[model samples]
Target: MAVELDPQLMDILACPSDDHAPLRAGTPTDPDADVLTCTSCGRGFPVVDGIPVLLLDEAIPPADSASTSRAGD
Candidate 1:
């Protein structure tokens, strides 16, 4: 059986670098299809090996390299 994720832990988990918006966990359709979407930025953060990859590049990188990347900025 899969371990039940701690609600409080999930509750406290915002976009890795973004604290302004909260994350709402979703049910993965496929075992490998894991993702957490940011409501504010409309970016999908992926979860791999039971870990959520919350970096912007992890979801979608800046249009250009010059953009000093920050989460949901």
Candidate 2:
């Protein structure tokens, strides 16, 4: 089953980072997965068992330049 979040809660969700910018819902890799992305810092937070893991330690940083950049694209 797809992990669903309440629209009302999503509206108030913000990044726990220093910037504390609003978070955007991300496309989950798995049906049971849910993710929230910080627009300002480019950090991603995972949601487990339908609960968003907003902890800073659990946040994933944006992809490195080496991994995101291609030789020619």
The prediction achieving the highest TM-score against the true structure is 2
Summarize candidate 2's per-residue lDDT along 20-72 as a digit string, tens digits. Answer: 89877773333343678787877778888879899999987665533566545
Total colliding residue pairs, candidate 2: 0
lDDT of 1 by residue, 41-71 (tens): 5456766767777777767432242255543
Best of the candidates, lDDT: 2
Worst 10 residues of 1 by lDDT: 24-33
lDDT on C-alpha atoms for all candidate structures: 0.57, 0.75
The superposed Cα distance between candidate 2 and the true structure at residue 39, in angstroms, equals 0.8
Query: Pairs clashing in candidate 2?
Result: none
Please give the lDDT score at residue 72 for candidate 2. Answer: 50
**Could you give me the TM-score of model 1 versus the true structure?**
0.57
- Give lDDT: candidate 1, residue 38: 57
